[model samples]
Every structure is written in C-alpha cells, then in structure tokens.
Target: MCWFSGLIALSMLVGMSSPSSAQSTAEPAKGRWTSLFNGKNLDGWVMKLKGSDLGENYKDTFRVEDGVIRVSYDKYEKFNGEFGHLFFHQPFSKYKLRIEYRFVGEQCPGGPGWAYRNSGVMIHSQKPETMSKDQEFPVSIEVQFLGGAERGTRPTGNVCTPGTHIVMDGKLITQHCNDSKSPTLRGDQWVTIEVEAHGNGTIKHFVNGELVIQYEKPQLDPDDRDAAKLLKANNGEKALSGGYIALQAETAPVEFRKIEIMPLDD
Candidate 1:
C-alpha cells in the first residue's frame, strides 16, 4: 500500500480505539451492577401466589407502574394470605443486590397485623415451581423490610428464614426472624437496602449503606414439608449455594423503585 493510504488507515484505527469512543460504546463489566427491574414492564419475572398456579398474578397484585414495581391489592376484598412472590428469571450464586423501596398505603383487609408494611427479598430461594400449592414462603434467606410503626421502633433490614436455617455469630439459629441493628424508617419514605450473598458463604444486609445483619450457611429444613421435597430432589443436599431471587408481596402495599444486582462470579 502507499505510505499516505497506510498512514490514513492507522489514524482511523487509533481514533476508533480511543478512550472516549470506547467509553461511549463499551458494555458494563460482568461484575458490574445491573438492573433487575426494567422500570417499564415485567419482562423477565414470574409471579407465584399461594394456592394459585405459577405465573398467576392474583388480583393484579404485582404490577409495574409509574416506573416502579408496585405490590398492591387494590382489587382484592381481603388478603386471604395470598402470600405472593415475583421471582426473577435468572438465578445467581454470588452477587450483591440493591433496591430502593418505600412502604405505601395500608395493608389489605384480613391481612395479618404483624405483616403491616412488611415485605422481603428472598435470596438463595427455591424455584417457584417447587413450591407447594399452598406454600406461604419458599425455602430461602429473607432480607426483611419493614416500615416504622406509629409508636415504636420497627427496624428494617432484618433477616427471616422460612423453611430454611442459618448460622449467626457461629451459632445455629432456629428462630424464624432475626432483628438487625438498623434504625427505624418511618412512614412512606424511601429506603435503600443492599444484600450481599456469597453463595453458601456469609450473607450481609445493609440499610442505607450501614451494615446491619450478617449470617452464614443457609440450608434447607428437612422438617419443612415443601423443603423436604427440595432436599429429596438434590439428594438430601441442605446447603443452599445458588438459587433464584424473589420479591415478596406480604399483604402490605409497597413500591420498589429500583432492583439491581452485580454478579461476583461467572
């Protein structure tokens, strides 16, 4: 090739590889945070409610509106312990999930009093298809979210295990719920929460960047009827290393504005 033509091609190639140009077109790294909720529709999520078939969105309970995922029961006469969940399509073994949510409106009629303004994000959860027709919750580690009460402190970022167990402070925890050291968030104010799940390793919860709760070794409960079936499927494997993510619809109305995750492994 002529010297002038070679020089022109080299310059064009260099321009295409320039930092500014690359930055504009480059995709995020494999471990970078990604949005789970697209803010406009439920394209990659599945809904499951107790006593209902998979993908059954009873009473339009889970919907995307106004650029957020809203868990509402405006069409229901009573909650009736529907206990719904919206599961993400993909499953992950190690990652950090961040979400911004706010409790809004009021609990549905006949909803449990203790579940007022309460919902959760379940990690390392059993698949939605594995749940019993009447299962209230899946076998997983719940990063519980709760709004403050009228007269007392109602801490958020707590941990709840349903049909599962965890070890905290090196001791096996058999309790249903474990409280965190986070301060109460009152009213309909938005709260940013983060959960870091490291497969079968330790998991940590953070409220507005403050680490509040930490636990380890989430495993299936052989005594739980539904979890026992899961155990049998895995040849009695108890340690939950990888599973789908799900958002709870536990009677109260809540709005999740953002749901994002950053994978830690391939």
Candidate 2:
C-alpha cells in the first residue's frame, strides 16, 4: 500500500476525521490557543434558526460588522419566538473557550421580556446538522451572559441547561437555570466570558477571569425530545463528554468580538 494511504488508515484507527474546508471543522493541536473567528467573515460557522433549514441564516439574523459578529434584527418586522444559534463547525472534547461580548441597541420588536441583554454560549452541543427543523435549541449546556443594571444583580456566566442536566456538590441539579456568583454587569461595556470544560468531568464559568460557577457530570435529559434522540443514538450514554460550541441569539441584540479556544488534555 502507498505511504499516504497507510497514514490515512492509521489516523482513522486513532479516530480523527480528515478536515474539510467546506466544513472547516478541524481540530487544533493540544494546548494551543486558536482563534475560531477570522474577524473577516463567517467562513467556518453555520446558522440554524427556528422555522429554517440547518444552513439558513434566517433573514440575516447573524452578520459580521466591524470585525465582530452581530446578531441583527434590523430587517425583521417582528421577533416571533425565533431563537437561533451559530455553531462552530467542529467539536472539542476538552478545552477552554473565551469570548468577549456586549449588549447592543434595543431588542427586536416583540422580543421576550426576559431576553433583554440576555445571550449565551452553548458547550457540548449537538451537531447542527442533526438538529430537527423547528428545534428551538440544541441539546447542550449553556453559559448564559446577562447585562443589566447593577442594582438588579443580573449576573453573567450563569448555567442554563436546555435539554441537559448536571451534578454539583455531589447532588444532581435538575433545574433549568442556575445563577452564577458574578457581579452585576450593565450597559454596553464589553465583558469577557470564559468557559473551562473538561469533557464531562468538570465545567466552569468565569467572568473576567474570576471563577463564577462550577459543575460536573453534564448529561442528557431523557425527557427532552432532543436529548432523547441523542441518547438513542449514542448507546444511551448519559454522561456527555464533548461536542460543538454555539453562540446564542435569543431575541436579544448582542455582539461578540472575539472567540478563542485552547484544547486541553483529557
């Protein structure tokens, strides 16, 4: 056999999918920080919003402006429960992800009251291609980012599970959202958010380098339709190790300036 063909077989034996430029879902070398966004365009990302196909951007809900990714609603006449996520092409088993974001101008018309200044990043998320049409969110764990008045005490870096559950302090946490210990951050000032996910062993949220919340053992919730489908396909493995990462657009105007990740050892 040819040397190149032998090398390909060896890679497959170790479970590494060859990179495709169309998908751009390539894995980086371990311990190296890589910038996922090129700051020029959305070349390696895919959009999936409500009532739209997997690759559809849905009325240009997400766009790049001034070297940043902006969730726009300028063309929308109304925000009718259209929740969306922009997913990176690949998944990481263990990594530290960091992004800078800020709340932008007015919320879209008819947006949810609770969604104001609310956005999140989904970690360990299901692949966008597998998401069913009309699925509001992927089966993942969310690192919620919030901006509001300091008096309101709305904290960023909170944990919110859409179709998942987690364990903390040796007990299972079944609730949907858990507030972080982050200080209140208001206005349009940019804030840095960081997430440390150790492949289902322990995941942590940090706001501006301060540890906010820590949890472990993120698993699928069988009662949820999306999670159930995932379980049926993955031999019913309840413990989630890793998956894709996605940015959230929950009817709130938000902007992300930078997104970087560093792969870690398992």
Candidate 3:
C-alpha cells in the first residue's frame, strides 16, 4: 500500500456526534487519560454494519469478552463482505488516543485476500447515522492495522484514506494508503498503537511508543462520492477537524484493549 509520497496539511477543526440517536459525550479533564472501553460492556459504543442500520451488531461481530473488545465472525457461516464498525460515538477534538490491539485466529471463509489480518481505527469519521445502508466504509482517516504473514513486509500502524485525503509539503496525497516506518510485528502479539491527533491540525502515529508516521491536514477528498456529499452538507467545506472514533472490522478477527485518551488543550 506504499502508493503515496507526500502528506497533507489543513486547519479546520470540528467535532460531530450521532451515537445510537443519543449524542452523549464525556468531558475528560485536560492532561488526564480517560478510558474509552470499560472492559466490562459496550456501554458507550454504537455499531454499524453494511446492509444494516446504524445500531446493529450484525452476527455479533463485535463483542466484549474477558474484558476486551473482540471482533469475531464465529456466527457467520461465511463472509459476505459485510464490513462493520464499533464507534465510541462521542466526538473528540484534540487528544492522544491509545489502543492495544492484536490479531488472532484465521480469516473468515470467503474473506477478501487484502483483508487478511487487517483492520483499523477510523478517526475523524462521519456520523454513523448519516452513512448509507450499503456503504462499505465511512469517510475517515484510517489508522490501518495489519498482522504479519509468512511472506514479505507487512507494516502496521499505517494510514489509509477511505473518503479523505492528507497533505504534506503543501501537496495533496492522491493514493489510498501510505506505509509507516514500523517493523513487521509477526504473530498474535499485543501491539500498542497510539495516535496524537490535534483535531485537524496534525496527526502522528506511534507503534510501541515509537513514532512511525506523521502527517498533517486531514481533509475530505472532494472526489469521493461519500465525501462529496459531506462537503455539500457542510456548505462545501472539506477541512476535517473532528468527529467520532471507530474500530474497523474487515474480515479478520482482532482484539482491542486499553482504549484510552487524554484530551489536549488547543
């Protein structure tokens, strides 16, 4: 996915919400880390699956088990490309987000080859309710997660744009995904991925406390069908500053824990 050479820069910062029809949020004290996942239940999250409404956890794809949010596909007899997302729902602006995730088990039958051991955390995303019923992915900046396979390099902590674009050196990155400098972490090992996001100012990715990819100015790509609608809705504005946080479930199974964040002052 190493197709982009330049990063992006923007200055628009806005927070949005629409969580299970209740736009509730918590005011985390600045400099204090607040847990996003309680390790008990899906108390503050909302589910969105392809071909389903905004609140359906299709086939129970995302569940809390043994104090971790596990993305599983055991109930499905086969894969149907029904991608899903578990949104924290609350909109956040400047913050340092932390997530420990690990890929496990095998890919679901009939799953796409590209999705093997692949998932992501979607930041600055569109509201779930605004998504089309058949929309495969929301317009967001994806902190792509990938587990190593038997072949060549497969770097995690990468960036993938779904309906968005990023800039660096004053040029828009036209590719869909960009590789990070992190080494391949093979096997089912716990990997800590941290993101320091300054609303729409700048976002940097860290793998195991080491910075791997840094970029700025994340904005909506006007060329994308979904993003174009969003630009129209926002009066043609494309600079994305803030929105919901989402956990992506592509066909592979993964687990997340220690989901926390510390609000950053503007």
Candidate lDDT scores, in order, read 0.81, 0.83, 0.84
Model 2 regions more than 4 Å off: 1-27
TM-score list, all predictions = 0.88, 0.90, 0.91
lDDT of 2 by residue, 1-266 (tens): 21112222333221124223254323566787788888878888888898898778888999999999999999899998789999887777789999999998988989888888889999988777767788999889999999985466798999999899999899999999999999998889999999998887899999999999999989889899888876666656677777778999988889999899999987
Better of 1 and 3 by lDDT: 3
Residues 172-230, candidate 1, lDDT per residue (tens digit)? 89899999999989989999999998888889999999999999888878898877776
- Could you tell me the TM-score of candidate 3? 0.91
- By TM-score, the best candidate is 3
Rank candidates by TM-score, best first: 3, 2, 1
| Pairwise TM-score winner, candidates 1 and 2 | 2
